[model samples]
Target: MMLSHYLIVSGILFSIGFLGVLLRKNTLVVLMSLELMLNAVNLLFVAFSRYNLSLDGSIFVFFSITVAAAEVAVGLAIVVALFRLKQTVFVDAFNEMKN
Candidate 1:
């Protein structure tokens, strides 16, 4: 496939994820959407790396994957904690966390 094909796919994935994040009220769904967005970016990076014959994009993808993993771990931990405290996973329910 061409670079434009990869970019188009990435754009679609990112837009879907962005809409999910914007419209979903559930924290878990939002997290999954965030992961989708991250994966879209990774896909773009890999595509660029393949077309350009450079190691830098792959290296960046490795770090991005690491960071995404850490983000999921911490995000899920927070979700679990919030669920334990409030018995719900809705984002609006987290407003009390300020206290």
Candidate 2:
């Protein structure tokens, strides 16, 4: 309800997501972490907007959701391609991008 509460929740979620992204070797887990971070940011935006009684934060959140949807589409496609090529989903196996 309050902005501080939302911020604290978002901070915790972001930290957890960051840890997941750092510790997980699986591509899927990494992507899920990314989603977690995005959702945390969205929550912060919405809470700030409500606190300020303005619509801009909500508008930005809307755009962020749109962008996140597009990212999911492209990210999943790329992951699928990686799986087909590497026969694995481990992030450490992603050597194709190396020079």
Candidates in order, TM-scores: namely 0.93, 0.94
Across residues 62-83, which tens digit of lDDT does each residue of candidate 2 receive? Answer: 8999999999999999999989
Separate clash counts for every candidate: 0, 0
In model 2, the clashing pairs are: none
Tens-digit lDDT track of model 1 for 1-99: 789999999999999999999999999999999999999999999999989999899999999999999999999999999899999999988886498
Assess each prediction's global lDDT (C-alpha) against the native: 0.95, 0.92
Q: What is the lDDT of residue 68 in candidate 2?
A: 93
- Deviation in angstroms for 69 in model 1? 0.7
